[model samples]
Every structure is written in C-alpha cells, then in structure tokens.
Target chain A: MKGTLIKTVLIGISLGLIWYTNSHLDIYNLSIVNNIGIFAILALSYNLINGVAGQFSLEPNGFVAIGAYMTAIFIIPMDTKIDMYALMDPAPVILQMQANFPIALLAGGLTSALMAFLLSVPVFRVRGDYLAIVTLGFGFIIRIFAMNSPAYTNGAMGLNDIPEFADFRWIGSITIFTFMVMIHVIYSKYGRAMKAIRDDEDAAVAMGVNTFKVKTYAFMTSAFFEGIGGGLLASFLSTIAPDQFTFLLTFYLLIIIVLGGLGSMTGTLVSAIVIGFGLEWLRFLDDNMNIFGYETGAHPGMRMVVFSILLIITMLFARRGLFGDRELSDILKSKRASKRKDA
Target chain B: MSKGILKIENITMQFGGVTAIDNLSFEVQKKEIYGLIGPNGAGKTTIFNIITGNYHPTKGEIIFGDETITGTKPNLVVQKGIARTFQNIRLFKSMSVLDNILIGFHNQSHYSYLEAIFRLPRYFGQEKKIKAEAMAILDEFDLTSFADHKATDLSYGNQRKVEIARAVATNPSLLLLDEPAAGMNPSETEDLSTIIHKIKQDFDLTILLIEHDMKFVNNMCDLVTVLDYGEKIFDGKPADAIVNEKVITAYLGDFTHA
Candidate 1:
C-alpha cells in the first residue's frame, strides 16, 4: 500500500513536469526530454533481456530497426510514401497506408516480437559470447537489409516526414507505464522463473520451470518494448534512416544500463535519463570554436571520446554500477532504520 | 506382490561405444525408501539421470505410476510428480534460501503473466498461499531462521537438507536424491537417514536414493538394490543384501579366479 502511494505520487510529479515542459519549453529542450523518456524505455527493455534474464544478448538494435521500419511503412501518408519511394517503385500493399498512432505502435511491437520469436529458435541455441556474436551479426544484417531494400525502406536515403504523434505526454505516459510493468514483472512469479534460469538453467529446469519457454517469453517481451520505444523515437523525430538504428545505438543503451546497474530497474531509469540528457547537453563539444581567438575548430567525435572515458571511469570505480543490483527501496529502508536507531 | 510406484525396466544408456548403464532394472514401491548402492562409476547417477529425463535410456523405458515416461524433458518429468536434487548441491547460489524454495513452486502457479504484472486478485491470492506454504515448510524443518540467508551461506549439512526441502516443495509423489549424505559427518549422516525415513512417511513420498554410506543404506532403506558396473547384482531386504555373495563381490572385488 505504501509502495503504491509512493509510485502514484512520483508518477504525478513526472506528469506535472511533462505538462509544464510541453507548454513552456522550446522544441529543442522538449526533444531532449523526449529522448530521455524514450531512452529510459529502451534501456529498461534492454536490461530485462541482458541484465535480469542474464542472456547477454546484443539484439536490441535489430529489433529496434524492425520497429522503426514497420512504423515508417505503416504510418507514412500515401502521398508522402509516393515522394519517399519515387526513386524506386513503392511496394503496393504497404504504400500510402495511414494507421493511427496506437495501431502503428502496436504493429511495430508485434512485428518486432514475431521477428524475435523466430530468431530465438536459432539464436538461443547458442549462449554467452557466441550468442553475442550472432546477435551482433544479426544487427548488422538488419541495417544492411534495410540499405539494400529500396522498396520497403527507401534504400540508403531513408524515410522522412514521419507523423509526430509522440510528444511529451505520449512519451511520458508510456515511459511510466513501461517502467511500472517491468517492475511488476521483476516481483512476479514469471520474473522469479527468469531469474532462476539466470542463476542456474539446469536447476531451474529440474525445479519444473520450462527454461526455454520462460526465456522465450522474456525475449519476446523485451523485443516488444524495444520496438515500441523505437517507433516512438521515429514518430517524435519526424524522420528516420537506416543508419539511425545501428549497433552504436545498441551500445549507447548498453552503456546506460551498465552505468545504472544490471538487474536494477531504478538504476537503469536514472542512468538512461542522465546519459540521454547528457548526450544532448554535451553536443557543444562537437561545435567549431574560436575560443580565446585560437580557432580551436570543431572536433567531429569529441562527445563520444568523453563519453567513452566516462564509461571506463565508471567501470573502474563502480564495477557493479551505481546500485550494484540493490534497489532504492533497500537503501531507503536501511537509511530509515539507521535514523530511528540514532533517535 | 503389489505394483511399484516407479519401475525402471531394462534401462540401457550408452555414450558412444561405452555403456554407462546396461540392462539395469529396479522397482521402488510407494511410500517406501529404496536404496541404490553401487561402486564408483557403476552408473547409479546415470540411472537417476534417465529416470528424471536428463538423459534417455538407449534401450528401455521408465514407468512411473502406470505411465511410461521414457524421453520426456526434465521440466515435464517434474510436473509429472517427480523431483530431484543433485550429487553436488545445485542450489541457485546467489538467491536467498526462501527464493530457492519458492522457485520449486514455479509449475504450481496458475496465474498468468498478465495477472502477475497487473497484480490481479489471483496473483496476490496465489502468492500469499505459496508464501505461506513455503514458510510452513521452513518452520517445520527448523530452517525458518536461515530462510533469508543465501542458499550457499548454509553449512554443507544444512545445504543438503535445504535441497530436500526444496525438492519436497515441488509436491512430488516420487523423490530422487543423488548422494544426499555425500559429505556429511557421521552425526549428520544419521540425522539425514532419520529425516529421509521420516519424510517418506510424512510426505507420503516414494524415495529412491543413491548412497555410498553402508550404514545409511542398512538403517533407513526398506529395500536395497545393488549395482556392479550398471548391472543389478542384488535386490532384497538390507539384511539379506549385506550377506549376498554377488553384492559382496561387487563392493569387495572378486577373488574366485585368483
């Protein structure tokens, strides 16, 4: 009951902030906030498969690409589709289809989920480094497939003019809902079964848990959320390209989850928001400068260099991330106990 | 004269050219504690593996309570009312003791994932019941104090008991214990023997255990089967099993040719 109260109050505060930002903030600032919300969803979903399930899978980029393309294809206006695919003849059935925002999002999630389910049959047969390699290879394959297929994805030029349905409210509400569902799952029996498989697969099987089936369920759910987050990103940006969904995108989410803490939902949320906003905040590092009239000039990838250093420092100092698999609730309870004792 | 709860019929397991178990057969009656005693590499654990579907027999079938369960996967085998512990403790080392036991109830949960995520009535209702049942098991076994500790935090004897407690939580009709008293001291071994016998009565379970300890086999087992290199050498009451020449030769080595 107490937890429910805390959750509701926190959600209300977030909604109030989102409403205020949507009304008063500039478009650029609003986009950064939206990025934080979207990245939080992506990182949370990634953590489910990689951290909580202990699969160490690197397939989020592939699933996210599926969502981006699926949303772009289904929601782009018929006239916009004709302009986008004019270089090559547009695919007949998918051309000019204008789905509502929710339908497009659902379609993207379901299609990505289907792809993940099919991939799991072959992919889950291998584990650890081999699974990582296969998934990494699959991520590249998705991008390359998009690049070569002009009809569906408009080849290299990519699709633009996507509908902007994912504003502050949509992103904020979905972020809260996704975050809540994941937390609920972590405390559920199915979540226990997933953790059991993570701890010991053979023992979980011996304990009457269907290790394969439970893992498949987790993998599919993770894909569903990643797809939805990806679609949200595309809709919010009003543009998307094959290059947008790369292994680098997967790496960014990975860094956030690692910096936050594996198996910690709150840690992922905080770290994703910090890194998401930090990326935008640090973009001045890439700007050409005449600092002190020296003409220092723009450094193309300076932001990433600093980001990589930050990640290395974090790995060295806090190897288990900020939370170390313990939650805020655990820390808060301990603090309250210590305060009572002091009194 | 009565049909057994578990019947291993002509179980033969081969790994390449080598046969781990060759034409081995045994019967464990209901509500009885059966002992499978064998020399090292005699395929005792192999039999357990076959019965629990970790491995399938090359040349025969396992019938548990009238159903022929030959090559069913390990998870379904447990759901079919059979559960087991490993030769070396295989508890989830990072999880709490209570969590380890609660996982044993994984198949027993009837709530859907939606129900769990939404915290539906069935979710809370079932979870409360499961938690109560798990706590009762802990209390009954005097493990209530260690319930919050990591499973690996316990002493070796306590770990062994916790494994049995977890297996029992699965609510199985037949329990397979692989070397339960493996590293126990004499007192611990005696305690385990007493507990096994008592659990057989209390849980209404058919227990088939592999033990190297002759004292445990002699004291706790209602019926004993002796294996020499995956072949059944003796099967009878412990009193007769100890004196049987073939059983003696299997353990003491054959000197007739010399």
Candidate 2:
C-alpha cells in the first residue's frame, strides 16, 4: 500500500514537472527535451529486443523509417504531397490516405509492427551473430527501397510539411507511458520468458517457454514503439528524408542502450538522456576553436570523432554499462538495506 | 514393474558424418529414478537431448505416456509433462530464485498479454497465486531464505537444487536431469540424493538422469542403463552393472598384470 502510494505521488510529481517545463522552456530547449523524450522511447523499445530478449537485431532503423514515412504520408495534406512529389506522380493510395494526428501515429506504428511480423518468419530462424547480420541487411534494404520508390516515398527528395502534431506534451506523456509499460513487462511472466531465452535458449525451451513466440512478441512490441518514435520525429522536424533514417540512427540507439546497460530499463532511460543531450552539447566541437589565440579550422563531423573516443573509453572502463543488468530500484533497495545494517 | 512410461526404440542421432548415438534403446518405468551412466562422450547426454526433443533422432521414435513425442518441439515436450536441467547449471542468470522458478510455471499462467499490460484483475490474481506457489516450492527445498537472491549467486549445490525446483514448478510427470550431482561435494551429493527421492515421492515424477558418479547412481536409481559408444552395454540392477565385465572394461581398460 505504501509503495503504491509512493509511486502514484512520484508519477504525479513527474507529470507536474513536465507540464511546467512544457510551458516555460524556450523553443530551443523544448526541442532538445522533446528529442530526448523520443529517443528515450526508441531506446527503451530497442532494449526489449537487444538487451532484454538478448537478440542482437539491427533493424530499428528500418522500422523507424517505415514509421516516419507512414505517419508523414497519412498526416500530410494531399495538396502538399502533390506539390512535394516532384520526381513522379504520387501513388493513388498515398493521395487518398488521410488521418487525424493520433490515428496517423497509430497507422505508422501498426505498419512497422506488420513489417516486424513478416520479418520474424525469416529473421527468427537465425540466432546470435547471424540474426545481427540478417537485421543489418534488412536496415540497408529499407533505405535502398525508400530511395528507389518515388511514387510512394518521393525517392531521394523525401517528404516535407509534415503536420506538427508531436509536441512536448505528447512526447513526454508517451515516454512515461512507454517506461511504465516496459517496467510492467519486465516484471511479468512474458518478460521472465524472454530473460530465460536470453540466459539460455535451450533451458528456456525445456522450461516450456515457446521461445519463438516470445521473441516475435518482443520484436513486434519493439517495432511498434520505434515506429511511434519515428512518427514523433517526423512531426517534430516537419521534414524527413531517406537519408535521415539510416544505419547511423540505429547505431546511435545502440550506443545509448549499451551505455545505459543492456537489460536495465532505468539504465536505458538515464543513458538516453545523457547521450541525447551529449550529442547536442558536443556540437560545439565541430565549430572552429580559438583556443589560446590559435584558431583551429572548423572540422565537420568532429563531434562524431569525439563520441567514438568516449565510447571506446566507456567500453574500456565499464563494459557492462552503467547498471550492469540491474535496475536503479534494485541498487537503491540494496543501499537502504546496507544502511539499516550499519544502524 | 508396471509398463514403461517412456520407451526409446532404436533411436539414432547423427551429426552430419559423425554418429553420436547409434541405435540406442531404453525403457523407464513410471515414478522410477532411472540412471543413464557412461564415460565422457558416451552418448548419455545425447539420449537426454533426443528424449527432450532438442535433437530429433535421425531415425527412431520416443513414446512418452502413450504419446509419440518424436520430433516434438522442446517447449511442447515440456508442456506434455517433461522438464530438464542442463549439465552446466543453466539457471536464468541475474534473476532471483523465485523468478526463475516462476518461469517454470510459464505455461500454467493463462492471463492474456492484454491483461498483463493493463494490470487487469486476472493478471494480479494469477501472478499473486503463482508467486505464492513459487514460494511454497522454495520452502519445500529449504531455499525460501534465498528466494530473493540471484540464482547464480547461490552455492553450486543450491543452484542445482534450484534448477530441480524450477523443473518441478512445471509440474512434469517426467523429469530429465543432466548430471545433477556433477560438481557437488559428498555431503551435498548426499543431500541431493535425499532431495531427489523426496521430489519423486512428493511430485510423483519419473526421473531419468545422466551422471558420471557411480555412487550417486547406485544409491538413487531403481534401474540403470550403461552405454558405451551409444550402444547399451548393460541394462539391469545397479549392483550387477557394477560387476559386469563389459561395463567394467568400458570404464577401465582390461587389467594387465605387470
């Protein structure tokens, strides 16, 4: 009873804080906050497959891309889409598709989930490193298909004038929702089955966990959230191109999950914030530096170089990540126990 | 003895060009602690794998409780009342002992994903019941104190016991334990022997186990099958198998007077 009360109070406080920040923060800071919230959703879902299920899949980019395109197509006005389709005539279905913001977001998520459902038939046939290779290839294939499909996707030109449906309020609430859902799952029987598969697939099978079914569910759920995140990203930017949804996006998420701790939800949440803000804060590294009166020329992509070094250093020092498969709650509980022991 | 509950007839397992088990056959009676003993790589574990449906026999059939379980998926085999432990202690690492045991009840919990996600009444009710059952199982094993500890952090004997508890949580009529006494001290092994017997009586489980420890097998098994190169060399009483010339020769080479 006490625990539930504490949790409800904490959630109330968090929602209040979000409301305050949404109204008070400037556009620049608000955008950064929104970006972090979206990434948090993406990373949490990705962790279900990569960290929680212990399936090394690299297909988030493809699903996210599908989400962005699907949402963009549904929400964009037919006239604006016709104007945007410069290379060729838009598909009849594309021009006909119309939905409100919520329905469009749902459409994006469902489409990505459908793709995941189809992909699981082939993707789950392989495990370990083979699964990683197959999914990486899948990411590449999505990008290439997007580049080639002009009628539906606008080819290399991408889409513009995406309705600004996603804001601090939507992203913030959804992030919290995603986090809570993930926690509920991690403590549920299905999550236990996934972890059993992760620890030992054969043993999990012996224990009567249908590994394939469990894996598919995890994959679909992950794709669903990734798609939603993608939809949010598209609306927030009001523009998206094939180039924006590349393997690099998946790579950034990968780094975030790894830095957070693979199987720890709290760790992923913290790392998403650190990496999200760190990426933006590190932008100054790319500009020309007048250090000690010695002007260093502006080095484009220098931020990436710094990030790589930091990742390497992190790997060298904390290989299992910040939490090492443990939650923040677990750490706190143990700390409290120790304090009582001292008392 | 009553009719056999499990029958493996002419089971052969081949990996590409290499034949791991060549025409192995055995029968385990209902509620008996059957032992499959052999030297290293003598196809003992192979038979366990074949029975559990991890690897389908190249050509043979396995009948479990009048059902042709041949080529069944591993999870389906478990659902049909067969659970197993690994030779290398394959507990779900980083999970608490209670959670690990709860996983064995995975198929038993029938709440839909929707219920689980929405925290429906059925979800809470079922989860609470399963958790209580898991605690009871832990208490039965005298592992209730360690219920919240990470399963991998327990002592080796306790880890093996936890694995057994997990398998038992599945409510299997037939339990396959691979080297249950593999790294235990004599006292721990003795404790394991008692636990196995108690489990057999309490759960009415027919146990088929693979162990290199002769003493452990001699004390625990009602029937013993000795295999050499995947061929059954002896199938009879444990004492007779120990005295059999062929079985002795298979384990220790022919005596040479020097």
Candidate 3:
C-alpha cells in the first residue's frame, strides 16, 4: 500500500513537471526537450527487440520511414499534398489519404506494425549476426522504395510543410506512455517469456514459450512505437525526406540504448536525455575553431567523431553501459538496504 | 496393468548423414517411472528430444494420451501435457527463481498482452493467482527461501530442483528429465531421488528419464530400457537388466577366452 502510494505520487510529480516545462520553456529549449521525448520512445521500443527480446535486428530505420511517410500522407491536406508532389502528379491514393492528427499517428503505427509482421516471417528465419544482416538489408530496401516511388513520396525531394501537431505535450505524454508500457511488459508473464527466449531459446521452447510468437510480438510492438516516434519527428521538424530516415538515425538510437544499458528501460530514459543534450552541446566542435594559435576550418561531421570517442571511453570504463541491466529502482532499493545496514 | 500414457513408435531421427536413433520404440504406462539408459552417444538424449518435439522423427510417430503428437512444435508438446529439462541446467540466468517458475505457467496465465500492458483487472488477478501457485510449487520443492534469488545462483542440487519445479509448474502429465542427476554428489543424488519420487506421487506424473546412474535407475525407475548403438538391447526390471547376458556384454564388451 505504501509502495503504491509512493509510485502514484512520483507519477503525479513527473506529469506536473512535464506540464511546467511545456508552458515555461522557449521554442529552442522546448524543441530539444521534444526531441528527447521522441528519442526516449524510439530507444525504448528498439530495446524491446534488441535488448529485451535479444534479437539483433537492424530494421528500425525502415519502420520509422514507413511511419513518417504514412503519417505525413495522412496528416497533410489534400490540396497541399498535390502541390507538394513536384516531381509527378500525386497518386490518387495519396490524394485520397486524409486523417486527423491522432488518426494519422495511429495509421503510421499500424502500417509499420503490419510491415513488421510481414518482415518477421523472413527476418526471423535467420538468427544472431544473420538476423542483423537481413534486417539491415530491410532498412536499405525501405529507403530505396521511398527513393523510387515519386508519385506518392516525391522521390528525391521529400514532403514538407507538415503541420506542427506534435508539440511538447504530445511527445512528452507518448514518451511517458511508452515508458510505462515497457515497464508493464518487463514485469508481465509475456515479459518473462521474452527474457526466457533471450537467455536460451531452446530452453524457452521447452518451457512452452512459443519462441516465434513471442519474438514476433516483440518485433511488432517495437515497430509500432518506432513508427509513432517517426511521425512525431516528421511533425516536429515540419518536413521529412527519405534521407532523414537513414541508418544514421538508427545508429544514433543504437548508441543511446547501448550507452543506457541494453535491457534497462530506466537506463534508456537517462541515456536518451544525456545523449540528446550531449549531441547538441557538442555542436561547437562542428564549427570553425582555433586550437591554441592554429585556426582550423569547420568539420561538418566532427560532432560524430567526438561522440565516438566518448562512447569508447564509456565502453572501457563501463562495458555494460550506464546501468548494466540494473534499473534505477533496483539501485535505489540496494542503496536503502546498505544505508540501513550502516545504521 | 495401467494403460500407456506415452507411446514412442518406431521413431527414427536422422541428421544429414548421421542416424541418431534408429527405429526406437517404447511405451510408458500411466504413473510409471521409466528409465532410458545408455553409454555416451547412444541416443538417449535424442529420444528425449524426439518425445519433447525438439527434433521431429525422420520416420515414426509419437502418441501421448491417445493423440498423435509427432512433428508438433516444442511449445505444443508442452501444451499437450509434456514438459522436459535439458542435459545442462538451462535456467534463465537473469530471472529470479520465482520468475523462472512463473514462465512455466506462461500458457496458464490467460491474459492478453493489452491487459498486461494496461494492467487490467484480469492481468492482476491472473498474475496474483499464478504467482501464488508458483510459490506453492517452490514450497513443495523446499525452494521457497530462494524464490527471489537468481536461478543460476542456486547450488547445483537446488538448481536441479528448481528445474524440476519449473517443469512441474507447466502442469504436465508426462515429465522428461535429461540427466537430472548428472553432477550431483551421493547425498544430493539421494535427496533428488526422494524428491523425484515424491513429485511423481504428488503430481501423478508418468516420468521418462535419461540417466547414467545405475543405482538411481534401480532405486527410482519401475522399469528400465537399455540402448546400445541406438537399438534396444534390454527392456525389463532394473534388477534383471544387470544380470542379462546381452546387457552385460553391451556394457563390458564381449570377453575373449585367452
């Protein structure tokens, strides 16, 4: 009873904090906060497959692309879509696509979920490194499809003038929802089955886990939220192109989850914030600067270089990432126990 | 005589060019503790795999409780009232002992993923019920004290007990144990034998076990089947197996008068 009260109070406090930040922060800082929220959603969902279910899949970029395109097509007005399709006339299906913001977001999620379901039949046929290779190809295939389909997607040029429906309110709420759902799953029976599959697939099969079904379920769930995250990204930026949903986006999320701790959701949350801010803060490295007395020209991708070095240092010092699969709550409980022992 | 609870009919398992089990046949009566013993590479574990649906037999069928279950998936085999343990202890290393056992009740917890994610009433109700049942199984195995400990952190004997408890939590009518006494000391082995007997009686289980311990076989099994080169060399009383001419020759090899 006391534990439940404490949790309820904590949740209330956090929600209040989100509301405060939404109302008080300026557009620049608020955009960073919204980006972090999207980051949290994407990383949390990705970890379900890569970390929790223990399937090394590299297909989030594909699913996110699908989500972004679907949501963009649905949310854009019929006239705007036709005007935006500069390469060729808009496809009849693309012109007919229309939905409210919530419906558009849901459509994005469902389409990606459907894609994930179809992909699993072939993707799950391989395991370990082969799974990674097959999924990486899947991401590539999605990008190529986007690039080739001009009538629907505008080909090389991407959709623009997307309505800014995904504000801090939307992103923040969804991020918390995603976090809560993940926690619920990690503590549920299906979650146990997932961990069982992660530990040893053969043993899980013997335990009647239906390894394929559990894995597919995890994959679809991961895709659904990743799609939504992509939708939020599209609306937040008010533009999206095939190029934006590349392996680089997936690579950033991979770095976040790895730096957070693979299987720990709390770790993912903390790492998302740290990496989100860290990336922006490191932008100074990309500008022209003087080292001592020598002036060097700006390096466009220098931020990534410094980021990689920091990751290497983190790997050397904390090989399992920030939390090493232990959640924040578990650490707190241990700390409390030690304090009591000291007393 | 009790009717057969499990029938293995002429099951042949072939992998590429190698034949693992050739025309193996066995029938385990209801509530009987049956033993499958053989030398290393003699297809004992292969037979267990075939029965548990890990390997579909290249040729034959498996019948459990009057249902033809050959070539079924491993999860379906467990759903059809068959559960098994591995030759090596394969507990989930990251999970607590309670969580490991709760996984055995995976099929039993009749709540949807939505309910679980949303924490609906059904989720809480089923989870509470299942956790209690898992704890009870642990209590029966005297593992309640280690319920929250990491399953791999348990002692070897306790780990074996936990595995058996997990298998029993699946509510299986037929239990397949692969080398349950593999690495136990004599006292641990004795305790294991006692616990196995108790569970067989308590759960009303028909057990088919693969073991190298002849004493364990004599003490626990009602009947023994001996295999040599994937062929049944002897099948009868455990006491009779030791004295059979073919069994002795199979174990010690044919002696030449010099």
**Tens digit of lDDT per residue, candidate 1, span A1-343?**
6867988899899889888888899988888888999989899999888888888889889988888888877888888788778558888877856688899998999988998888788877655566678779889999999999888788988889998888988888889888888888877778888888888888888999987777887888899999998899889888888898888889989999999998788999999888888887898999887878788789988999999999999999999898766568756865786687699
Segments in model 2 whose C-alpha atoms lie over 4 Å from true places: A338-343, B256-258
* lDDT by residue (tens digit), candidate 2, B180-238: 99989999999999989998998899999999999888999999999988888999989
Residue A242 Cα positional deviation in candidate 1, in Å, after optimal superposition: 0.5
In terms of docking quality, how is candidate 3 classified? high
User: Per-residue lDDT of B107-191 in model 3, one digit per residue for the tens?
Assistant: 9999998899998889989999999999999998999988877899899999999999999999999999999999999999999
- The sequence of per-residue lDDT tens digits that candidate 2 reaches over residues A111-201 is 9999899988887876668778877988899899989999999999999999898989889988998888888788789989988999988
Docking class of 1: medium
lDDT of 3 by residue, A105-127 (tens): 99999999998999888777556
Clashes of 1: 1
- Candidate 1: stretches off by over 4 Å: A125-133, A281-298, A330-343, B243-245, B252-258
In candidate 3, the second chain superimposes onto the true chain B with a TM-score of: 0.98
Candidate 2, residue A214: Cα displacement in angstroms equals 0.8
* DockQ-superior candidate, 2 or 3: 3
